[model samples]
Target: MTFAGFLGLALQTIKAPRDVARLLLSARLSSEALWTAFALVVVLNTLVFSATIALMPQDGFGLLGNPVAFMVVQAAALAGAVIAIASIGRAMGGKADLAQVAVLLIWLQSLRVLAQAALMIIGIASQPLAAGLALGVSVLGIWLSMNFIDEAHELGSLFKSAGVLILALMALAVGLSLLLSLLGVVPQGMNGYV
Candidate 1:
Protein backbone atom coordinates (compact mmCIF):
# COMPACT_ATOMS: atom_id res chain seq x y z
CA MET A 1 0.00 0.00 0.00
CA THR A 2 1.12 3.55 -0.62
CA PHE A 3 2.02 5.83 2.30
CA ALA A 4 -1.19 7.74 1.64
CA GLY A 5 -3.22 4.56 2.03
CA PHE A 6 -1.47 3.81 5.31
CA LEU A 7 -2.18 7.32 6.48
CA GLY A 8 -5.85 6.94 5.56
CA LEU A 9 -6.18 3.67 7.45
CA ALA A 10 -4.45 5.18 10.45
CA LEU A 11 -6.81 8.12 10.39
CA GLN A 12 -9.79 5.79 10.17
CA THR A 13 -8.44 3.75 13.07
CA ILE A 14 -8.23 6.90 15.15
CA LYS A 15 -11.75 7.88 14.19
CA ALA A 16 -13.39 4.57 15.06
CA PRO A 17 -12.57 2.40 18.07
CA ARG A 18 -15.09 -0.26 17.06
CA ASP A 19 -13.32 -0.72 13.77
CA VAL A 20 -10.00 -0.96 15.59
CA ALA A 21 -11.47 -3.78 17.66
CA ARG A 22 -12.73 -5.54 14.57
CA LEU A 23 -9.32 -5.35 12.94
CA LEU A 24 -7.25 -6.28 15.98
CA LEU A 25 -9.42 -9.23 17.05
CA SER A 26 -9.40 -10.53 13.50
CA ALA A 27 -5.57 -10.38 13.57
CA ARG A 28 -5.60 -8.84 10.14
CA LEU A 29 -3.45 -5.87 9.23
CA SER A 30 -3.94 -4.41 5.83
CA SER A 31 -0.63 -3.30 4.31
CA GLU A 32 -1.41 0.37 4.81
CA ALA A 33 -2.96 0.07 8.26
CA LEU A 34 -0.80 -2.61 9.86
CA TRP A 35 1.46 -0.43 12.03
CA THR A 36 0.19 3.01 11.20
CA ALA A 37 -1.99 3.34 14.26
CA PHE A 38 0.83 2.50 16.64
CA ALA A 39 3.21 4.92 14.99
CA LEU A 40 0.69 7.71 15.10
CA VAL A 41 0.02 7.14 18.78
CA VAL A 42 3.70 7.07 19.65
CA VAL A 43 4.25 10.29 17.75
CA LEU A 44 1.33 11.94 19.51
CA ASN A 45 2.63 10.73 22.86
CA THR A 46 6.14 11.97 22.20
CA LEU A 47 4.79 15.39 21.34
CA VAL A 48 2.75 15.54 24.52
CA PHE A 49 5.59 14.29 26.65
CA SER A 50 8.07 16.68 25.08
CA ALA A 51 5.77 19.57 25.78
CA THR A 52 5.32 18.49 29.39
CA ILE A 53 8.99 18.05 29.92
CA ALA A 54 9.72 21.38 28.37
CA LEU A 55 7.24 23.11 30.63
CA MET A 56 8.73 21.51 33.74
CA PRO A 57 11.52 23.38 35.52
CA GLN A 58 14.89 21.83 34.83
CA ASP A 59 15.79 21.86 38.52
CA GLY A 60 12.56 20.23 39.61
CA PHE A 61 12.48 16.79 41.16
CA GLY A 62 9.83 14.06 40.88
CA LEU A 63 9.10 10.46 41.94
CA LEU A 64 12.06 9.43 39.93
CA GLY A 65 15.10 11.58 40.56
CA ASN A 66 17.07 11.63 37.29
CA PRO A 67 15.73 12.68 33.91
CA VAL A 68 16.54 9.28 32.42
CA ALA A 69 14.68 7.48 35.18
CA PHE A 70 11.76 9.84 34.79
CA MET A 71 11.67 9.08 31.10
CA VAL A 72 11.73 5.35 31.83
CA VAL A 73 8.86 5.68 34.27
CA GLN A 74 6.93 7.67 31.70
CA ALA A 75 7.57 5.00 29.11
CA ALA A 76 6.29 2.32 31.48
CA ALA A 77 3.26 4.43 32.17
CA LEU A 78 2.66 4.71 28.43
CA ALA A 79 2.84 0.94 28.11
CA GLY A 80 0.35 0.63 30.94
CA ALA A 81 -1.91 3.08 29.19
CA VAL A 82 -1.87 1.01 26.01
CA ILE A 83 -2.71 -2.09 27.99
CA ALA A 84 -5.58 -0.27 29.65
CA ILE A 85 -7.04 1.03 26.39
CA ALA A 86 -6.68 -2.35 24.73
CA SER A 87 -8.34 -4.08 27.65
CA ILE A 88 -11.26 -1.66 27.50
CA GLY A 89 -11.63 -2.18 23.78
CA ARG A 90 -11.61 -5.92 24.35
CA ALA A 91 -14.23 -5.61 27.08
CA MET A 92 -16.43 -3.53 24.79
CA GLY A 93 -16.24 -6.35 22.23
CA GLY A 94 -14.18 -4.20 19.87
CA LYS A 95 -10.79 -4.77 18.40
CA ALA A 96 -8.07 -2.19 19.03
CA ASP A 97 -5.35 -2.06 16.44
CA LEU A 98 -1.97 -2.35 18.16
CA ALA A 99 -1.00 1.02 16.68
CA GLN A 100 -4.19 2.68 17.82
CA VAL A 101 -3.91 1.02 21.19
CA ALA A 102 -0.36 2.29 21.56
CA VAL A 103 -1.42 5.79 20.61
CA LEU A 104 -4.31 5.80 23.05
CA LEU A 105 -2.10 4.49 25.80
CA ILE A 106 0.64 7.03 25.15
CA TRP A 107 -1.81 9.92 25.10
CA LEU A 108 -3.59 8.78 28.26
CA GLN A 109 -0.35 8.12 30.12
CA SER A 110 1.06 11.49 29.09
CA LEU A 111 -1.85 13.20 30.84
CA ARG A 112 -0.92 11.55 34.10
CA VAL A 113 2.67 12.56 33.65
CA LEU A 114 1.68 16.12 32.89
CA ALA A 115 -0.60 16.16 35.93
CA GLN A 116 2.16 14.89 38.15
CA ALA A 117 4.49 17.55 36.92
CA ALA A 118 1.89 20.21 37.49
CA LEU A 119 1.16 18.98 40.99
CA MET A 120 4.80 18.92 41.85
CA ILE A 121 5.28 22.42 40.54
CA ILE A 122 2.36 23.57 42.65
CA GLY A 123 3.80 21.82 45.70
CA ILE A 124 0.57 20.01 46.42
CA ALA A 125 0.59 17.83 49.51
CA SER A 126 1.18 14.27 48.44
CA GLN A 127 -1.52 12.90 50.71
CA PRO A 128 -3.90 10.16 49.63
CA LEU A 129 -6.74 12.62 49.11
CA ALA A 130 -4.53 14.92 47.11
CA ALA A 131 -3.24 12.03 45.06
CA GLY A 132 -6.77 10.82 44.39
CA LEU A 133 -7.81 14.29 43.31
CA ALA A 134 -4.87 14.59 40.99
CA LEU A 135 -5.64 11.21 39.49
CA GLY A 136 -9.26 12.19 38.98
CA VAL A 137 -8.24 15.35 37.17
CA SER A 138 -5.77 13.45 35.04
CA VAL A 139 -8.42 10.89 34.15
CA LEU A 140 -10.81 13.66 33.26
CA GLY A 141 -8.21 15.19 31.01
CA ILE A 142 -7.79 11.85 29.29
CA TRP A 143 -11.55 11.54 28.86
CA LEU A 144 -11.69 14.99 27.39
CA SER A 145 -8.94 14.05 24.99
CA MET A 146 -10.94 11.02 23.84
CA ASN A 147 -13.80 13.29 22.90
CA PHE A 148 -11.71 14.38 19.94
CA ILE A 149 -12.30 10.98 18.40
CA ASP A 150 -15.30 11.00 16.09
CA GLU A 151 -16.69 7.79 17.55
CA ALA A 152 -16.90 9.17 21.07
CA HIS A 153 -19.74 11.48 21.91
CA GLU A 154 -21.19 12.65 25.23
CA LEU A 155 -18.89 13.50 28.11
CA GLY A 156 -20.51 10.89 30.36
CA SER A 157 -19.79 8.02 27.98
CA LEU A 158 -16.28 9.29 27.40
CA PHE A 159 -15.62 9.40 31.12
CA LYS A 160 -16.95 5.88 31.55
CA SER A 161 -14.86 4.52 28.72
CA ALA A 162 -11.66 6.29 29.80
CA GLY A 163 -12.18 5.26 33.43
CA VAL A 164 -12.66 1.62 32.52
CA LEU A 165 -9.58 1.72 30.30
CA ILE A 166 -7.42 3.28 33.00
CA LEU A 167 -8.65 0.90 35.70
CA ALA A 168 -8.16 -2.15 33.51
CA LEU A 169 -4.63 -1.05 32.67
CA MET A 170 -3.83 -0.29 36.30
CA ALA A 171 -5.07 -3.72 37.34
CA LEU A 172 -2.91 -5.41 34.76
CA ALA A 173 0.14 -3.40 35.83
CA VAL A 174 -0.45 -4.25 39.48
CA GLY A 175 -0.86 -7.93 38.64
CA LEU A 176 2.34 -7.97 36.66
CA SER A 177 4.22 -6.13 39.39
CA LEU A 178 2.94 -8.63 41.93
CA LEU A 179 4.06 -11.56 39.83
CA LEU A 180 7.48 -10.04 39.43
CA SER A 181 7.69 -9.35 43.14
CA LEU A 182 6.79 -12.92 43.93
CA LEU A 183 9.58 -14.11 41.70
CA GLY A 184 12.01 -11.71 43.44
CA VAL A 185 12.50 -9.78 40.26
CA VAL A 186 10.68 -6.64 41.23
CA PRO A 187 12.47 -3.50 40.08
CA GLN A 188 14.38 -1.33 42.47
CA GLY A 189 12.42 1.32 44.42
CA MET A 190 9.30 -0.81 44.20
CA ASN A 191 8.25 -1.81 47.70
CA GLY A 192 6.31 -4.92 48.78
CA TYR A 193 6.45 -8.49 47.58
CA VAL A 194 3.61 -10.31 45.91
Candidate 2:
Protein backbone atom coordinates (compact mmCIF):
# COMPACT_ATOMS: atom_id res chain seq x y z
CA MET A 1 0.00 0.00 0.00
CA THR A 2 1.10 3.61 -0.53
CA PHE A 3 1.86 5.95 2.34
CA ALA A 4 -1.46 7.69 1.87
CA GLY A 5 -3.28 4.37 1.94
CA PHE A 6 -1.62 3.38 5.21
CA LEU A 7 -2.47 6.70 6.80
CA GLY A 8 -6.04 6.39 5.58
CA LEU A 9 -6.25 2.93 7.12
CA ALA A 10 -4.92 4.24 10.40
CA LEU A 11 -7.50 7.00 10.45
CA GLN A 12 -10.22 4.48 9.71
CA THR A 13 -9.03 2.34 12.60
CA ILE A 14 -9.61 5.29 14.88
CA LYS A 15 -12.81 6.66 13.38
CA ALA A 16 -14.43 3.41 12.29
CA PRO A 17 -12.72 0.58 14.04
CA ARG A 18 -15.04 -2.25 13.07
CA ASP A 19 -14.90 -1.31 9.39
CA VAL A 20 -11.13 -1.02 9.47
CA ALA A 21 -10.85 -4.36 11.20
CA ARG A 22 -12.95 -5.96 8.44
CA LEU A 23 -10.74 -4.60 5.68
CA LEU A 24 -7.52 -5.39 7.49
CA LEU A 25 -8.50 -8.94 8.35
CA SER A 26 -9.84 -9.59 4.87
CA ALA A 27 -6.58 -8.68 3.11
CA ARG A 28 -4.27 -11.68 2.86
CA LEU A 29 -0.69 -10.53 3.28
CA SER A 30 2.29 -12.68 2.46
CA SER A 31 4.65 -13.59 5.29
CA GLU A 32 6.94 -10.82 4.06
CA ALA A 33 4.19 -8.22 4.27
CA LEU A 34 3.18 -9.39 7.73
CA TRP A 35 6.73 -9.20 9.05
CA THR A 36 7.31 -5.87 7.34
CA ALA A 37 4.24 -4.37 9.03
CA PHE A 38 5.32 -5.89 12.35
CA ALA A 39 8.81 -4.41 12.10
CA LEU A 40 7.49 -1.02 11.06
CA VAL A 41 5.18 -0.88 14.08
CA VAL A 42 7.96 -1.86 16.47
CA VAL A 43 10.42 0.66 15.09
CA LEU A 44 7.87 3.45 15.13
CA ASN A 45 6.92 2.59 18.70
CA THR A 46 10.53 2.66 19.80
CA LEU A 47 11.11 6.04 18.21
CA VAL A 48 8.02 7.48 19.86
CA PHE A 49 9.15 6.10 23.21
CA SER A 50 12.62 7.56 22.85
CA ALA A 51 11.20 10.96 21.93
CA THR A 52 8.87 10.84 24.94
CA ILE A 53 11.80 10.32 27.27
CA ALA A 54 13.76 13.05 25.56
CA LEU A 55 10.93 15.51 26.12
CA MET A 56 10.20 14.62 29.73
CA PRO A 57 11.63 16.81 32.50
CA GLN A 58 14.75 15.39 34.04
CA ASP A 59 14.54 15.23 37.80
CA GLY A 60 15.97 12.00 39.16
CA PHE A 61 15.64 10.38 35.76
CA GLY A 62 19.07 10.31 34.20
CA LEU A 63 19.66 9.63 30.51
CA LEU A 64 20.92 6.16 31.37
CA GLY A 65 17.81 5.30 33.41
CA ASN A 66 15.38 5.41 30.52
CA PRO A 67 12.43 3.01 30.25
CA VAL A 68 13.88 1.05 27.37
CA ALA A 69 13.49 -2.14 29.36
CA PHE A 70 9.84 -1.31 29.94
CA MET A 71 9.37 -0.86 26.22
CA VAL A 72 10.86 -4.28 25.60
CA VAL A 73 8.57 -5.79 28.19
CA GLN A 74 5.63 -3.97 26.67
CA ALA A 75 6.32 -5.42 23.23
CA ALA A 76 6.68 -8.92 24.60
CA ALA A 77 3.45 -8.58 26.53
CA LEU A 78 1.58 -7.46 23.41
CA ALA A 79 2.90 -10.42 21.42
CA GLY A 80 1.91 -12.82 24.16
CA ALA A 81 -1.54 -11.29 24.41
CA VAL A 82 -2.16 -11.80 20.71
CA ILE A 83 -1.17 -15.46 20.95
CA ALA A 84 -3.37 -16.12 23.92
CA ILE A 85 -6.36 -14.34 22.47
CA ALA A 86 -6.06 -16.11 19.14
CA SER A 87 -5.73 -19.53 20.73
CA ILE A 88 -8.54 -19.05 23.18
CA GLY A 89 -10.64 -17.16 20.73
CA ARG A 90 -10.54 -20.11 18.37
CA ALA A 91 -11.69 -22.39 21.16
CA MET A 92 -14.50 -19.94 21.71
CA GLY A 93 -15.45 -20.20 18.00
CA GLY A 94 -13.84 -17.03 16.75
CA LYS A 95 -12.46 -17.30 13.18
CA ALA A 96 -9.46 -14.98 13.03
CA ASP A 97 -6.10 -16.66 12.53
CA LEU A 98 -2.90 -15.85 14.37
CA ALA A 99 -1.56 -13.72 11.53
CA GLN A 100 -4.74 -11.68 11.44
CA VAL A 101 -4.68 -11.18 15.18
CA ALA A 102 -1.06 -10.09 15.13
CA VAL A 103 -1.62 -7.68 12.28
CA LEU A 104 -4.65 -6.16 13.99
CA LEU A 105 -2.70 -5.65 17.22
CA ILE A 106 0.13 -3.96 15.38
CA TRP A 107 -2.28 -1.70 13.56
CA LEU A 108 -4.04 -0.78 16.80
CA GLN A 109 -0.74 -0.02 18.49
CA SER A 110 0.41 2.05 15.52
CA LEU A 111 -2.74 4.10 15.84
CA ARG A 112 -1.91 4.71 19.49
CA VAL A 113 1.64 5.75 18.71
CA LEU A 114 0.35 8.16 16.11
CA ALA A 115 -2.16 9.62 18.55
CA GLN A 116 0.54 10.04 21.17
CA ALA A 117 2.81 11.78 18.70
CA ALA A 118 -0.03 14.14 17.81
CA LEU A 119 -0.74 14.75 21.49
CA MET A 120 2.87 15.61 22.16
CA ILE A 121 2.99 18.00 19.21
CA ILE A 122 -0.26 19.64 20.26
CA GLY A 123 0.98 19.92 23.83
CA ILE A 124 3.38 22.60 22.65
CA ALA A 125 0.36 24.80 21.90
CA SER A 126 -2.14 23.74 24.60
CA GLN A 127 -1.12 21.75 27.63
CA PRO A 128 -4.63 21.29 29.00
CA LEU A 129 -6.04 19.88 25.77
CA ALA A 130 -3.11 17.60 25.38
CA ALA A 131 -3.43 16.37 28.93
CA GLY A 132 -7.15 15.69 28.52
CA LEU A 133 -6.62 13.85 25.24
CA ALA A 134 -3.76 11.87 26.74
CA LEU A 135 -6.30 10.16 28.98
CA GLY A 136 -8.81 10.01 26.14
CA VAL A 137 -6.18 8.42 23.94
CA SER A 138 -5.74 5.56 26.36
CA VAL A 139 -9.48 4.91 26.60
CA LEU A 140 -10.02 5.28 22.87
CA GLY A 141 -7.20 2.85 22.11
CA ILE A 142 -8.73 0.15 24.30
CA TRP A 143 -12.14 0.78 22.79
CA LEU A 144 -10.77 0.56 19.28
CA SER A 145 -8.93 -2.63 20.04
CA MET A 146 -11.96 -4.18 21.67
CA ASN A 147 -14.07 -3.45 18.60
CA PHE A 148 -11.36 -4.42 16.16
CA ILE A 149 -10.72 -7.72 17.87
CA ASP A 150 -14.39 -8.53 18.02
CA GLU A 151 -14.94 -7.79 14.38
CA ALA A 152 -11.82 -9.56 13.17
CA HIS A 153 -12.64 -12.72 15.06
CA GLU A 154 -16.36 -12.57 14.25
CA LEU A 155 -16.71 -12.93 17.97
CA GLY A 156 -20.42 -13.21 18.80
CA SER A 157 -20.68 -10.34 21.24
CA LEU A 158 -18.74 -7.19 22.02
CA PHE A 159 -19.00 -7.84 25.75
CA LYS A 160 -17.50 -11.31 25.39
CA SER A 161 -14.60 -10.07 23.33
CA ALA A 162 -13.95 -7.25 25.74
CA GLY A 163 -13.97 -9.68 28.62
CA VAL A 164 -11.45 -11.85 26.88
CA LEU A 165 -9.23 -8.88 26.07
CA ILE A 166 -9.41 -7.59 29.61
CA LEU A 167 -8.53 -10.96 31.00
CA ALA A 168 -5.57 -11.21 28.68
CA LEU A 169 -4.39 -7.76 29.76
CA MET A 170 -4.72 -8.65 33.43
CA ALA A 171 -2.78 -11.84 32.91
CA LEU A 172 0.01 -9.98 31.14
CA ALA A 173 0.13 -7.30 33.78
CA VAL A 174 0.39 -9.81 36.59
CA GLY A 175 2.91 -11.91 34.71
CA LEU A 176 5.11 -8.92 33.91
CA SER A 177 4.90 -7.66 37.48
CA LEU A 178 5.93 -11.04 38.82
CA LEU A 179 8.76 -11.34 36.34
CA LEU A 180 10.00 -7.84 37.15
CA SER A 181 9.82 -8.48 40.87
CA LEU A 182 11.74 -11.76 40.55
CA LEU A 183 14.44 -9.87 38.66
CA GLY A 184 14.43 -7.15 41.34
CA VAL A 185 13.46 -4.61 38.71
CA VAL A 186 10.58 -3.45 40.86
CA PRO A 187 11.50 -3.33 44.51
CA GLN A 188 9.05 -4.51 47.14
CA GLY A 189 6.37 -2.19 48.60
CA MET A 190 6.48 0.08 45.57
CA ASN A 191 4.06 -0.14 42.67
CA GLY A 192 4.65 -3.21 40.50
CA TYR A 193 4.30 -1.38 37.18
CA VAL A 194 7.21 0.26 35.42
Candidate 3:
Protein backbone atom coordinates (compact mmCIF):
# COMPACT_ATOMS: atom_id res chain seq x y z
CA MET A 1 0.00 0.00 0.00
CA THR A 2 1.09 3.57 -0.63
CA PHE A 3 1.74 6.04 2.20
CA ALA A 4 -1.56 7.76 1.40
CA GLY A 5 -3.44 4.49 1.69
CA PHE A 6 -1.72 3.71 4.98
CA LEU A 7 -2.48 7.14 6.39
CA GLY A 8 -6.08 6.94 5.21
CA LEU A 9 -6.61 3.58 6.86
CA ALA A 10 -4.95 4.75 10.06
CA LEU A 11 -7.23 7.75 10.16
CA GLN A 12 -10.19 5.49 9.44
CA THR A 13 -9.16 3.26 12.31
CA ILE A 14 -9.45 6.21 14.63
CA LYS A 15 -12.62 7.57 12.98
CA ALA A 16 -14.48 4.37 12.09
CA PRO A 17 -12.71 1.31 13.43
CA ARG A 18 -15.59 -1.05 12.89
CA ASP A 19 -15.55 -0.28 9.19
CA VAL A 20 -11.79 -0.82 9.07
CA ALA A 21 -12.18 -4.09 10.88
CA ARG A 22 -14.79 -5.21 8.40
CA LEU A 23 -12.56 -4.22 5.51
CA LEU A 24 -9.65 -6.16 7.00
CA LEU A 25 -11.75 -9.26 7.57
CA SER A 26 -13.00 -9.10 4.02
CA ALA A 27 -9.42 -9.01 2.75
CA ARG A 28 -9.10 -12.69 3.76
CA LEU A 29 -5.38 -12.48 4.29
CA SER A 30 -3.77 -15.91 4.07
CA SER A 31 -2.38 -17.43 7.25
CA GLU A 32 1.16 -17.12 5.91
CA ALA A 33 0.65 -13.50 5.04
CA LEU A 34 -0.90 -12.79 8.41
CA TRP A 35 1.98 -14.45 10.26
CA THR A 36 4.55 -12.63 8.16
CA ALA A 37 2.88 -9.33 8.88
CA PHE A 38 2.66 -10.20 12.56
CA ALA A 39 6.40 -10.89 12.69
CA LEU A 40 7.21 -7.70 10.85
CA VAL A 41 5.15 -5.63 13.26
CA VAL A 42 6.70 -7.33 16.28
CA VAL A 43 10.20 -6.64 14.99
CA LEU A 44 9.34 -3.09 14.17
CA ASN A 45 7.94 -2.65 17.65
CA THR A 46 11.13 -4.07 19.13
CA LEU A 47 13.19 -1.60 17.14
CA VAL A 48 11.04 1.23 18.40
CA PHE A 49 11.39 -0.08 21.94
CA SER A 50 15.16 -0.18 21.66
CA ALA A 51 15.16 3.38 20.46
CA THR A 52 13.01 4.40 23.41
CA ILE A 53 15.38 2.76 25.87
CA ALA A 54 18.34 4.43 24.23
CA LEU A 55 16.65 7.79 24.40
CA MET A 56 15.51 7.43 28.00
CA PRO A 57 17.57 4.84 29.72
CA GLN A 58 15.71 3.36 32.62
CA ASP A 59 16.92 1.64 35.75
CA GLY A 60 15.57 -1.85 35.27
CA PHE A 61 14.60 -3.35 31.95
CA GLY A 62 16.78 -6.34 32.91
CA LEU A 63 16.03 -9.24 30.54
CA LEU A 64 13.73 -7.06 28.45
CA GLY A 65 16.67 -4.78 27.74
CA ASN A 66 18.03 -7.46 25.46
CA PRO A 67 16.52 -6.87 22.03
CA VAL A 68 16.12 -10.55 21.07
CA ALA A 69 14.52 -11.44 24.38
CA PHE A 70 12.26 -8.43 24.07
CA MET A 71 11.19 -9.56 20.60
CA VAL A 72 10.46 -13.08 21.83
CA VAL A 73 8.36 -11.77 24.70
CA GLN A 74 6.63 -9.32 22.40
CA ALA A 75 5.75 -12.06 19.91
CA ALA A 76 4.53 -14.39 22.63
CA ALA A 77 2.43 -11.71 24.31
CA LEU A 78 0.84 -10.69 21.02
CA ALA A 79 0.19 -14.28 19.95
CA GLY A 80 -1.32 -15.03 23.32
CA ALA A 81 -3.60 -12.02 23.02
CA VAL A 82 -4.79 -13.10 19.57
CA ILE A 83 -5.47 -16.63 20.81
CA ALA A 84 -7.27 -15.34 23.87
CA ILE A 85 -9.48 -13.06 21.79
CA ALA A 86 -10.39 -15.84 19.39
CA SER A 87 -10.91 -18.48 22.02
CA ILE A 88 -12.79 -16.36 24.49
CA GLY A 89 -14.95 -14.77 21.81
CA ARG A 90 -15.86 -18.23 20.48
CA ALA A 91 -16.58 -19.46 23.98
CA MET A 92 -18.83 -16.46 24.45
CA GLY A 93 -20.70 -17.42 21.23
CA GLY A 94 -18.95 -14.92 18.96
CA LYS A 95 -17.80 -15.98 15.47
CA ALA A 96 -14.35 -14.55 14.79
CA ASP A 97 -11.60 -17.05 14.08
CA LEU A 98 -7.94 -16.81 15.18
CA ALA A 99 -6.68 -15.48 11.87
CA GLN A 100 -9.36 -12.82 11.82
CA VAL A 101 -8.37 -11.57 15.26
CA ALA A 102 -4.69 -11.83 14.43
CA VAL A 103 -5.03 -9.62 11.39
CA LEU A 104 -6.70 -6.81 13.30
CA LEU A 105 -4.24 -7.03 16.18
CA ILE A 106 -1.28 -7.01 13.81
CA TRP A 107 -2.61 -3.92 12.13
CA LEU A 108 -3.13 -2.26 15.49
CA GLN A 109 0.36 -3.13 16.60
CA SER A 110 1.76 -1.68 13.37
CA LEU A 111 -0.06 1.52 14.13
CA ARG A 112 1.24 1.50 17.67
CA VAL A 113 4.80 1.35 16.36
CA LEU A 114 4.15 4.37 14.23
CA ALA A 115 2.65 6.22 17.16
CA GLN A 116 5.59 5.33 19.37
CA ALA A 117 7.98 6.57 16.73
CA ALA A 118 6.12 9.85 16.47
CA LEU A 119 6.02 10.20 20.23
CA MET A 120 9.77 9.56 20.40
CA ILE A 121 10.47 12.29 17.91
CA ILE A 122 8.13 14.64 19.74
CA GLY A 123 9.79 13.80 23.04
CA ILE A 124 13.02 15.11 21.69
CA ALA A 125 11.33 18.50 21.37
CA SER A 126 8.94 18.53 24.34
CA GLN A 127 8.66 15.79 26.95
CA PRO A 128 5.38 16.95 28.46
CA LEU A 129 3.62 17.11 25.09
CA ALA A 130 4.93 13.69 24.15
CA ALA A 131 3.67 12.27 27.43
CA GLY A 132 0.25 13.78 26.85
CA LEU A 133 0.13 12.41 23.32
CA ALA A 134 1.12 8.97 24.62
CA LEU A 135 -1.79 9.05 27.03
CA GLY A 136 -4.15 10.05 24.23
CA VAL A 137 -2.87 7.29 22.00
CA SER A 138 -3.40 4.77 24.79
CA VAL A 139 -7.01 5.81 25.21
CA LEU A 140 -7.46 5.70 21.45
CA GLY A 141 -5.91 2.24 21.37
CA ILE A 142 -8.44 0.97 23.88
CA TRP A 143 -11.30 2.43 21.89
CA LEU A 144 -9.98 0.96 18.66
CA SER A 145 -9.58 -2.47 20.24
CA MET A 146 -13.17 -2.47 21.43
CA ASN A 147 -14.46 -1.61 17.98
CA PHE A 148 -12.18 -4.08 16.25
CA ILE A 149 -13.19 -6.90 18.54
CA ASP A 150 -16.85 -6.09 18.22
CA GLU A 151 -16.64 -6.11 14.44
CA ALA A 152 -14.45 -9.19 14.23
CA HIS A 153 -16.67 -11.31 16.44
CA GLU A 154 -19.92 -9.83 15.23
CA LEU A 155 -20.44 -9.07 18.89
CA GLY A 156 -22.98 -6.44 17.83
CA SER A 157 -22.16 -3.99 20.63
CA LEU A 158 -19.27 -2.15 22.22
CA PHE A 159 -20.46 -3.40 25.63
CA LYS A 160 -19.92 -6.98 24.56
CA SER A 161 -16.55 -6.10 23.11
CA ALA A 162 -15.61 -4.45 26.39
CA GLY A 163 -16.68 -7.59 28.21
CA VAL A 164 -14.52 -9.72 25.96
CA LEU A 165 -11.56 -7.38 26.47
CA ILE A 166 -11.90 -7.51 30.24
CA LEU A 167 -12.14 -11.26 30.32
CA ALA A 168 -9.19 -11.67 27.98
CA LEU A 169 -7.06 -9.32 30.09
CA MET A 170 -7.98 -11.11 33.28
CA ALA A 171 -7.11 -14.43 31.71
CA LEU A 172 -3.79 -13.09 30.48
CA ALA A 173 -2.96 -11.70 33.89
CA VAL A 174 -3.75 -14.94 35.67
CA GLY A 175 -1.84 -16.93 33.08
CA LEU A 176 1.16 -14.65 33.36
CA SER A 177 1.10 -14.87 37.12
CA LEU A 178 1.01 -18.62 36.98
CA LEU A 179 3.84 -18.73 34.45
CA LEU A 180 5.99 -16.43 36.57
CA SER A 181 5.25 -18.49 39.62
CA LEU A 182 6.20 -21.63 37.79
CA LEU A 183 9.47 -20.13 36.69
CA GLY A 184 10.08 -18.81 40.21
CA VAL A 185 10.42 -15.33 38.82
CA VAL A 186 8.12 -13.76 41.37
CA PRO A 187 10.14 -12.31 44.20
CA GLN A 188 9.64 -13.66 47.67
CA GLY A 189 6.77 -11.98 49.57
CA MET A 190 5.51 -10.53 46.28
CA ASN A 191 3.87 -13.73 45.08
CA GLY A 192 0.46 -12.84 46.44
CA TYR A 193 0.50 -9.43 44.80
CA VAL A 194 1.18 -10.92 41.40
Could you tell me every candidate's TM-score relative to the true structure? 0.43, 0.83, 0.91
TM-score winner between 1 and 2, please give it. 2
Off by over 4 Å in 3: 178-194
Q: Point to the candidate with the largest lDDT.
A: 3
Q: Residue 76's C-alpha lDDT in candidate 3?
A: 75
Residue-pair clashes per candidate: 7, 0, 0
Better of 2 and 3 by lDDT: 3
Ranked by TM-score from best down, the candidates are 3, 2, 1
The CA lDDT at 133 in model 3 is: 98
Q: Is candidate 1 or candidate 3 better by TM-score?
A: 3
User: What is the C-alpha lDDT profile of model 1 across 87-191, one tens digit per residue?
Assistant: 665566544544555544433443444555555545334455656777777656554445432132222455556665556667768865654455444355545
Worst lDDT 10-window in candidate 3: 179-188
